[model samples]
Target chain A: MDRILYGDNQFFAVNHISDAKSMEQSMKFKENDAIIATLDQAIEAGIDTFMCTTHDRIAFVCDAVRSNPEKYKDFKIYPCMPYAHKYANAVTELGIQGTIKQYVPGNFFGSMFKGGKALVSKDYLAIMELLVDAEMKMFEGVKTPVVFLQNVITDLLLGLGMDEILKGFHDYVREKYDVEPGFITMNLPKLAETLEGLGIENPIICASINSANFRMSGGKELYEETLRTKKIRVIAMQVLGGGAIPPKEALGYVCGLPNIESILFGASSKRNIDNTVSTIHEFDSK
Target chain B: MLRVALVGAGKMGLSHLSILGAHPNVEVVGVCDTSLIVMGALKKYTKFPCYKKFTKMLDQEKPDAVFVAVPTKLHYEMIKELLDRKIHVFAEKPFCLNPEQGSELARLAEEHNLVNQVGYHNKFIGTFKEVKRIIESGALGEIYHFTGEAYGPVVTKKKDSTWRSNPADGGGCLMDYASHVIDLLNHLISPVASAEGTLLKSIYSQHVDDAVYSLLKLESGETGVLSVNWSDDTYRKMSTSVSITGTEGKIISDASELKVFVKKEGALDGYTKGWNVKYVTQLTDQVDFYLRGEEYSAQIDYFVNAALKKGPNDINTFKSAARTDNAIALIKNNSKTKA
Candidate 1:
């Protein structure tokens, strides 16, 4: 894992604080060129990894990075799967069969055949892998060292008591993509325990890790206890506690924690990005 | 532990089942769905009993409470049956396609003295919850104007026919999308008394409206605007927000954050004369089981606790949802009158 990973929530209209700011960011990154410029600023600030969701617009970002190999030679993208809202909207508008026809990869006739068979047998793992392959097509030939399961599906599976699907995703991604598999969740402690129970040890998990325990399901102590005794590498996210805690205090809390291998953050401005990097560096130096 | 069962294994149903299945105070006895595929998967994967028919499941499992997550067209029959059996019930939002059926069911629940709730999960969101609290504190004194808006990318392109394009299924921007905003308005501010200058526009659907625009008058004699569009591809997901202006201050909030601007220094406690911003992180409480968002699990836990304590049917009750349903009726009627 990189010491610092840039996120893509700001590129999309996802803001935890205000919708007005989100609309402003949506206009600011309306074109791929603007998003590439921001990525360049992150690279100039010494961050090398971009952890992003597999939204349709991200395909353009991947194209820009793949075409300019020299400029982004060492840049890596940590792709997160299923892009949630894509499937949600598709399912609502297109229904199940139509959604499969629209999103399942490979030849149309072949996907239809396999989709029907998968639906018949209720082979959820098969459908999951097909969707994973569909979502991963954009990242082809790009440097992707790690793939993450988005928290929507991760937390759903955790609550559903379907630990096998989590294991299935991990094994398939590792065997096919040959990259480390990661899971993002709101409840880090339960997911760590669930993974360990499935005989999978030392997994990579990213979650909200702040002193305020904002969106930290089950609270802060369980997460801290898990980090102290568990054998999992963590990527601390939402370190600013949904923009409530100040950056210095937020970074201080996260960087001082044990077992946190990296911090993931997204910012729309160069000044904010540079400030976060310096704050992390300052805390690390101590 | 309270014995619980769920009907309809669709998207929202599955989300509710996942949360309730892990709840400490609940024991999931049976799950009934029309899809044999979903039932078979649940029976194979989890320990809960699965059934094909709701009536059969009700007879065999005899649960103390039931969660009705079927389409709006099916809510009346399912919830009525549950209330008749003296079982507590929690039904999904836009409670029923017909407002009269919703009111009758609300009356039935009250007559039977059973715990009844309609799921309007936004009320449990911290930022929006804070919006209600601030308004109640008179922080925004003499509330004069408000706006409730929501947009999403649900119907960005034309596709084959589904339940969304069917009015009988309680589908469209008004029932499916705008109802959320209207419910929030009723909960946080005042219930809408009338609507005029209404426009229901169809962007991509042939049979249903994709956008809803209307001018609303609250029962308190104040007015506001209701603007909602589900065909907006600019937004990645559903973004619903509320803004209120008053004599002393103003407030703007979505599910994740809250913003307030006061005119005086001592207008509200902990709020300066200038703008004060608050995030959901500090305002939200922890949930035992989380999926999609904290609001989902929080609402379920609230219902469970309410049932356990035999508390008043005050929050998100069928009565409240029926109020929202009445507001939807007013909007539809206003559109017809204008046309």
Candidate 2:
């Protein structure tokens, strides 16, 4: 189970619910580390998409990996590079591969870390413009994953036809540059199967792709098709299910999925990171 | 009020019937088509008398307005018969296979002072108003480029003889799909200063094209690209999206939804200071303008209104539809050379 973790208070939090903003700090501090620990604890777990909180934290994760390459050999790190200036050098220097989750909302913790330039909104028509500009500057010599963060499923619901959009963007970018950049979705209801069916063969960083609400319903054949489809790079989200379940139990549930590649964690403080590591250790022992 | 008789009791003929059926000022007493299947279907479906030959129908109905929804190759003969009868026409698109025929109908419409309209529904969609607003506002910065793309699953499932799929019947992607874009560009920009259009039969490899891509240069120094294709995969795709970037702001719409993104500046001096995103919902407005605040209906009401009011033709006239005819001509000409 090449499990990937996803929790992006530090990545691209939509601030969809009002309570999300209220619990912003504690959730960011606690749940975020739980994600990392979940990764470290599970023998099957790996890190596919990581949103670096600070330069120091990113360096710390890099250092931790560099120090114990064998210990984390199966783990592939994909650090978030949201901006062209600040994180660009850090990500390029550290040689992190994955997405540059462009946080649209200003209030998200990682938004400021986006270095004041790259935070783009869904309303902006010229999204490709920013991507092209970023590629020209920081990504000139780099060949790494650059994923876009789409916060809400509302636009996906309303007009954009989220599955079609994911496919279209993938097709457009791949055709233009022959590069495989990606986008991430979290907790979108009634879309897991559709998202899974779309022919996107890229890495998806999520928490709970197989939750009860967004479960793989229909017959066994349909369920298997949903699990094995090509376009869907399932990044299971809400693994902790809003911190309701024990982190270890959540890790086990996510790791059971045969197709899941990574789970994202939002670690705000060092204690959170340590807790995440402990959780991962516990998962590994299990 | 202009007495209208709609020929070809098919999908398009029924659409016109519904509109004329509702308009109190317009009387649609006659309908004609070769398809007894459709005619029989319409006997119960419509309240109009159906006939086979248009000449006998024309003689009997003596309609002042006739809408031709027959096959493409037959459009010229049917429209010419109506023009000879001094009847105003509302012809379905591909005004007639090539520009020469389109030019002929346009001249006749002009000569008879008849209000002729063609079926190009996108021009009547609600988003064009927003497009026009954005263009006039000069918000999208210096408008250097505009592109429109419309596509759907290629109708490979259809039999080989579907008029929409046969070159003799004006079947192909360029004439069927890209023609909308060409007419729209001509409507929005200046009459397409110069254009280079290409049609590809790569995806389906049938006698007809599965895709068409056209590059155009407008007189305004703006370059435009239009894509028309039958995207044959699992997903069905049909869209007409427009993007215009000007000196100050941008206007982009898929017609399904219209949005204009503008750049705002400094607040009141010593009073306020901030910037904000402005969301302009222009789709509803466009619908109101296009349908004259009535529900989205056929262009015949407007045409009849224009005729009765002796006003401008709200529907696409033979002149406007001729642009598509010209573009189709270019695509066919290019396809032959490439072959």
Give a tens-digit lDDT track for model 1, residues A1-286. 8899999999987887677778899999999889989988999999999999999888988998889999889999999987888788777876655676678665543643554332433466777788888889999989999999999889877877777788989999999999999999988988999999998979999998998887788888888999999999999999987677899999999999999999999998899999999999999999
Q: Chain A TM-score for each candidate, in the given order?
A: 0.94, 0.48
Q: Write the per-residue lDDT of candidate 2 for residues B182-262, one digit (tens) a residue.
A: 777777765665557455665654677778776777666788787777554322234556766655556566544554555
Question: What would the TM-scores of all predictions be?
Answer: 0.95, 0.50
Model 2: chain B TM-score relative to the native chain B:
0.86
Residue-level lDDT of model 1, residues B50-157, one tens digit each, is 888899999999999999988899899889889989999999988998779989999999999888888899999988988888899987889889999999888888
| Stretches of model 2 off by over 4 angstroms after superposition | A1-286, B154-159, B197-199, B232-237, B264-282, B285-298, B335-339
For all candidates, the clash counts are 0, 39
Tens digit of per-residue lDDT, candidate 2, span A104-206: 2233325333453322333122343344444323322233344343432211221112244445555655566565544443322224444445644444533
Off by over 4 Å in 1: A107-122, B310-312
- Give the Å shift of residue A270 in candidate 2: 34
Q: If chain B of candidate 1 is superposed on the true chain B, what is its TM-score? A: 0.98
Candidate 1 lDDT at A146 equals 92
